[model samples]
Target chain A: LAKTTQPISMDSYEGQEVNITCSHNNIATNDYITWYQQFPSQGPRFIIQGYKTKVTNEVASLFIPADRKSSTLSLPRVSLSDTAVYYCLVGDVSNTGKLIFGQGTTLQVKP
Target chain B: DAGVTQSPTHLIKTRGQHVTLRCSPISGHKSVSWYQQVLGQGPQFIFQYYEKEERGRGNFPDRFSARQFPNYSSELNVNALLLGDSALYLCASSLIRVDNSPLHFGNGTRLTVT
Candidate 1:
């Protein structure tokens, strides 16, 4: 499993774009980067995933550099409800069942 | 379609006691995984079951065991628990058929050891 490094916490105002970067220096060639959002007392929710380049979805966008050692999760026009802890995980498709989580970046969206 | 469901949203147990947690996956899903989340920390994988067989396990002790039913439902059992065993236990379901399919998690059963 590739270890991930992210910010401890971040504060942002509402309607502003928030970007969280996660670094996995040991990412393998077969590994894919995935992001999940978790609120207090709730299970983590899948946000976005990408192998390389950029992948956009309804909720967030994931940008993976050519090296695949780092990825960024970009949330556009954030709201107060978007405040939560976001986790970045790197694992292979066949072995994702045994994912290892990091400390995660706590995004605090203030009004 | 119902998502993953776990029984007993909260539980209080004493040291040296045993506890059982149950989880029912979404319809047509066949893989279930267990994770333990301590306060202020990320979840740690405990076990994974696929098609009623144990697929993988984490670095937990033998006191923690799990089994999957033929219907794909799963149960996690912990014996001779200690105070440090208190944490939120989460059950997630996913299909191996889908590449990079994200896990669907339950609200989790909070276990408080007294």
Candidate 2:
């Protein structure tokens, strides 16, 4: 499991883009970076995932550089409802669900 | 399709007591995993089961055990509960073939140890 470090919290206004970066200096070769979002009193929801370069989905985009030691989750045009905790996880799925979640970055999207 | 579902949305137990939390995986999902989420903290992996077999486990004590049923449902058992055990218990399910697939989670059971 690759221990991930990320900002404790971030603040942004509605309609702004928010990017949360995670650092995994000890990422393994097979490790994949994934992000999740959670609202108060709810379970975390999958946001995006990537191995290297960049990957985008309807919800968010993941950017991983060539080094693969770090990844960034970009939420475009955020809204107040998007305020939630974002978690960055780096692990090998081949290890059979050894997901270790970090403390996560609490994004506060202001109206 | 119905997503993952957990029973007893909320529960209360005293120290040293035992509790069983249940979860029903989504239709066609063959794997179920349990996580413990303390207030103001991220969730910690507890256990993962697939094909009615233990596939993985976290650092939780032996007091915490789980098993997947024949129908792909799961039960998380906690014995000798402690105050620190009070937290939101989340159940996530996914197909075991592709581990990178997103995990579908239930609303979770809020367990309060008094």
Error of 2 at A61 (Å): 0.9
- Model 2: per-residue lDDT, tens digit, A1-111? 899999999999999999999999999987889898999889898888889999999989999999998999999999999999999998875457658887999999988
For all predicted structures, in order, the TM-scores are 0.98, 0.97
How would you encode candidate 2's per-residue C-alpha lDDT over B1-114 as one tens digit per residue?
Answer: 888889999999999999999999999988899999999999899999999998999999999999988999999999999999999999998887785776778989999999
**Separate clash counts for every candidate:** 0, 0
Q: What is the lDDT of residue B108 in candidate 1?
A: 96
Q: Considering the two chains of model 2, state its CAPRI-style docking category.
A: medium
* Angstrom error at residue B38, model 2: 0.6
Compose the digit string of candidate 1's lDDT tens values, residues A4-99: 999999999999999999999999887889998999989898898889999999988999999988999999999999999999999963554889
Model-by-model DockQ, in order:
0.68, 0.63
- Alpha-carbon runs more than 4 Å astray in model 1: none
Model 2, chain A: how large is the TM-score? 0.96
Report the number of the highest-TM-score candidate. Answer: 1
What value does DockQ give for candidate 2?
0.63
Model 2 chain B weakest 10-residue run by lDDT: B95-104
